[model samples]
Target: MAQSSRRSSISGPSQHNALVSQNQVVLYNASSKGLTVNYIHPACHTVEEPDASTCPYCHRPLDEYNHSAPQAPTSDHRAPNYFHLLAIHNESTSRPLTPPHLEDEARPPLSSETMAEGYFDAFFREESKLGMGANGSVFLCQHVLDGNLLGRFAVKKIAVGSSHKYLVRILKEVRLLETLRHPNIITYHHSWLEPCRFSTFGPSVPTLFILMQWAEGGSLDDFIAQRRGISHGDTYQNSASPESEEAHMTKAQRIAAFKARTGAGASGTSRPANLKAVHLLSTDEIVSLLWDITSGLAFLHNRSILHLDLKPGNVLLTWDPNVLIPRGMLSDFGAARDMLHQGSRTGVTGTLEYTSPEIIMPDPMTGALRQTDSKSDIWSLGIILHKLIFFHTPWRNGNDDFSLLEQEVIAYPGFIPDPSITSACSRRGLPTELLTLLQSLLDRAPGRRPSCEKILLAIEEHK
Candidate 1:
């Protein structure tokens, strides 16, 4: 996998450093520096290149960002490969995005219409708050189409202050979400900006409203926390004949029951630190979700993008009444970047626990951390897999000291689960092959780590 450069040459503010929001409208202006002025980026900048040469947004000359041959899977769906599944799902479910010039003909001017009649009342009806953060809040909303409630969507409302750099970062995220289509990745719906006050007495700022597909099952971390309650002698064990009680229940019902006991809800909550142990997910479910996550990662890699942050919190779960397990979809791309044009790191990015050693470990000679690549993401995936099977990370500093954690991770020697976890894996029928894969994913040498494609191949072979 060769590295890809950032398509957009303009540097923007990142959500990590500035207030930001997520929404679904494309408005690009060549002169406007702030997001308040409707600077829409051309969708072509994020995805595979099109035939036209001029920039659709700025009417400036265009240059090819990616010259490499496309890495899309074969059209033959008859093959039993995991890539085929992703290809089929993407083709069937993802809508063809309209080009910038043809945007008016493709869809109604909903952006203007919503702005005329208050965004929430005219377009979507707000339901409940899903999650809130320093810069923005995500809400569960019902899409009001033709005077009837359609489907639920997660709308992220971000307060975009007067910062050109942050505006650019938000644009990068929106452009990526708008064009990147995959079943295991959250779908972008619509986005537009409106001025709203962050507080009652405070002045209003440009709040970006990003509409996206709602994952009903919350996040993977939420799922794990509820499962931990079950392991801690919660309702499942306390019930009279728990096995018989749940024999006819659906996956949603089982999870709901667990949530009721654990005080979990649609918006995820952190697991209590007191809960020292957690119930391990079944091997089948783990493998299935692994396939979902790896498939999404593989698609991004194919596009020459690196998901620098791949952790449980960033993986949302979508539940179906008929399906036995919830599907994992990758979310939160604030830390992701185009691997092809990546530059030297100013500081380490991503969650400390899941960040690869190559990114966090200092050089022996220069005493500076090395640049990361696709393999750095594989190490994060390995940590996720470890938490899935053992209910905890393989290595920890047990404190908030970054240096200590970095040192511990550098010396980790690739973890093999203890007897208790191995015994659980045995009872759950986890294949030894998977354990081998997990260890290899955490290999200290990034070059030795398996690519997402290789991981999917291993899964297909085992299946």
Candidate 2:
């Protein structure tokens, strides 16, 4: 008697068994839309159609497919598209079925709780307006959570419909600030994207708020004016002879006499004696201030950054009187750029008076204005130094003649006062080494100018 062949039972409605050999059973699934079934082989397991009806090696029924046709010896070699099928097979149960949706309620939605605590409240609170600029308004905000005085921060709420270039420039400034960390450089504390709250705007536009350490003394330009007034008063009081009010009287008389005398002259030149009353800085103080500024610039340049706008307004003094020298902190990194190895070129950047000649003059060979690089920054620094010492910019009195201005700058290279003046008309005469350093820094050719490190070294050696 022949041995009875045992057939394997299907576990689900989608699952079915097909005969592989006399004793072997293969599981498979029938296509729900059609009578055709997909064959799943048990050994050398794969989903495919069998050829002919008998197994290729075993010479038995191709039980992989659930069909009345005779088993094929070999399986049809074709790739299967699993995506089309709605069911997946379970290896353990040998069944085809759908699984549960585990992701539906796995996580909770984020509400006001998940957000930064007190952020919304602090952002919405009424802030004391501090300053306004082209981009946005600054507000002195109170930290809601800690109640800590978040020292004078500028809440720069950007304007909507702003040009892409302006936005890019603003972002670059922020990025530059982010990488920069120095004592002299302004600190960029934090910045964040917030919804615009202006009454005129629709729904909400994207606005960026930058938190920075505010300069208490305002711009260097204002500071210089204040200093000038104080210095003038000090000069008047000190020069007043104690022995006789007559000395002061004579000084005033000589000035009036000189003005009367000069009334007949067409030329604007005044007598040296009349100009003697001008209270200029002592040589020592001027040199010291120059030294301080150069040191700040050196630090910035060593870090591969250029202060494109180095002027009186940008150099800030910390508010401490005992600190004899102006402990200057370089502000406004907005125009700064990396220039360790780049060549100098001129472009329409920086203040006109402080802008370098290389920027103003186009290179004949390239026919392009040199991009203001590190050397261009040095030129600006030289101008700033001249202003700090002389209390006047070199280009202040220049007529609208571009060629004449260029010639004057090229000829002088640096500040050039009359050689015959006996009095210390400017800040006390700077030391020889300091003066030499300034001259070198203010060279006509960018290549001729000394590196910021060299300048720092010279200052230290002189000290």
Report lDDT (CA) for all predictions: 0.63, 0.51
Candidate 2, overall lDDT? 0.51
Q: Indicate the worst ten consecutive residues by lDDT in candidate 1.
A: 15-24
Candidate 1 TM-score versus the reference: 0.65
Highest-scoring model, lDDT: 1
The candidate scoring highest on TM-score is 1
lDDT of 2 by residue, 24-90 (tens): 4344565432212323344333234344344433444434333432211122211122211212221
lDDT tens digits, residue span 1-463, model 1: 2112222212123211010011111122223311221223445344465622333333433233222333222111111122122222223332222112322333433232223124445547889989775547999997553354434679888876554455556757777876776778887655655556768899966566777778888888778767765442244211122322343368788777766755677774845565544456887888988998999999899999888989887899987547889889898887888988888788988887888878877788999778788998899999888878766675534325667777877777886656765675777888877888998898888899999989999988765
TM-score per candidate, in order? 0.65, 0.56
Cα lDDT for residue 126, candidate 1: 84
Please identify model 2 stretches exceeding 4 Å from their true place. Answer: 1-150, 154-165, 196-205, 230-279, 282-288, 320-322, 340-346, 398-413, 421-433, 461-463
> For each predicted model, how many residue pairs clash, with residues at least 3 apart or on different chains?
19, 23
lDDT of 1 at 441: 94
